[model samples]
Target: MGALAGLAPIFGAIGTGISVLGTIQAGREAKAQADYQAKVQEMQADEAQAASQRDAAATYRQGRLIASQQRAAVAGAGGDLTDPSVIDIMADTDFETDLAARTDIYRGEQQARGLNDAAVNSRISGKNAQKAAFISAAGNLFSGVSNMYSRFGAQAKTTATASGSTRPLYG
Candidate 1:
C-alpha cells in the first residue's frame, strides 16, 4: 500500500502526458485534413479555369467561322464587299467574339481567385485549431499537476494525524 501510494503522483503525471499527447495528435490530424481539403479546392479551381479558357477558344473559333461565312456569302452574291456597311459588320462580329472570349477568361480568373481565398481561410482555421489544442494541453497539464499535489497533501495530512503528530509525513 505504501509503495502504491508513493507511485500515485508518477502514474498521474504519466496519464496526463498521454492525454496531452493524444490531444496534440488530434490537432495535427485536423490540420492535415484541412490542408488536404485546401489542395483539393485549388485543384478544382485550376480545372475550372482551364475549362473556361477552352470554352472561350471554342467560342472565338465559332465566331470567326460565322464571320467568314457571312463575308463569303456577300461576295458570292455580288454584293458590295468593299462597302463601308459590309466592312463594319465584319468588324463588329470580330469585336463581339473577342469581347466574349475576354469575358470568359475574366470569369475563370475570378473563380480561381475565390478558391484561393477559401484555401487561405482553411489554412488559417487549421492553424487556429492547433493553437487551441496546445492551449488545452497546457491547461490539462496544469490541472493534473494541481490534482497530484492536492492528493499528496491530503495523504500527508492523513498520515500525520494517524501518527498523532503535527509534522508532515515527508518531513
Candidate 2:
C-alpha cells in the first residue's frame, strides 16, 4: 500500500503525458485532413475553369458560324447585305453569344472562388483545433500535477502525525 501510494504521482504524470500525446496526435490528424481537402478544392477549381474556357470557345465558334450563315442568306435573297439593319442584326447576335459565353465563364469562376474560400476556412478550423488541443493538454497536465502534490502533502502530514513530529517528515 505504501509503495503504491508513493508511485501514485508518477502514474498520474504518465497518464497525463499519454493524454497530452493523444491530443497532439488528434490535432495533427485534423490538420492533415484539412490540407487534403484544400488540395481537392484547388483541383476541382482548376478543372471547372478549364471546362468553362472550353465551353466559351465552343460557343464563340458556333456564334461565328451562325452569323456567317445569316449574312449568306441575306446576300442570296438579294437584300443589301451591307444594309445598316442587317449589320445591326449580325452584331446583336454576336454580342448576345459573347454575353452568354462570358456569363458561363463568370459563374464557373465564382464557384471556384467559393470552393477556395471553403478550403481556407477548413484550414483555419484545423489550426484552431490544434490550438484548442494544446490548451486542453496544458490544463490536464496542470490538474494532474496539482492532484499529485495534494496527495503527497496529505501523506506527509499523516506520517508526521504518526511520528509525533511538529513538522512534516520530509520538510
Candidate 3:
C-alpha cells in the first residue's frame, strides 16, 4: 500500500514532463500547422489526464489486493482464526465459540505487543530523565564548590591580618 502510494508522485512528474514537451513542440510549429496544433494540444491534455487516472486506478487496485492478501494470511496463519480449516470445524462447532477463541488469541497478541512497546518506551524515558537529573546535580555541585573556594580565601585573609603577617596584596 505504501509503495503504491509513493508511485503517485512519480506518475505526476512523468505526466507534467510530457505536457511541457507537448506545449513546447506545439508552440514552435503552430504557424505551419495551425489546425493540427490545436488538436495536438487537446489530445496531449486528454492523454495525460487519462494516463494519470489509469495509473491511480492501478495503484488503488494493487493496494487493495495487497491488503486482502495480508488479511487472508492472518486468517490462515492461526488454526482457529475463521480460516478454511476452521470452517470445516465450525460446521459442527458453535459460531460464538470459534469467534471468541479467535478474538482472544488476537487480543493476546495485541496486548503482548503493547506491553513490549511500553517497556521499551519506559526504559528510554527513564534513561533520559536520569541523564537530565545528573546534569542538573553536577551543575549545582560545581557552583557549591566555587562558593566554598571563595569563602576559604576570605577566611585566610582575615587570619593573616589578625596574625600581623604581611602578605602581597597584588600577586
Best by TM-score: 1
Residue 21 in candidate 1, Cα distance off native in Å: 0.5
| TM-scores for every candidate against the unseen true structure | 0.85, 0.83, 0.33
Global lDDT of each model?
0.88, 0.86, 0.52
Best by lDDT: 1
Candidate 2 achieves a global lDDT of 0.86
lDDT per residue as tens, model 3, 87-149 = 554443444444444554555455545545554554555455455545555554555455444
Clashing pairs in 1: none
RMSD of model 1 against the true structure? 5.6
Q: Worst lDDT window (10 residues) for model 3?
A: 28-37
Clashing pairs in 2: none
Positional deviation of residue 135's Cα in model 2 after best superposition, in angstroms = 1.0
- In model 1, the Cα lDDT at residue 86 comes to 96
Error of 1 at 141 (Å): 0.9
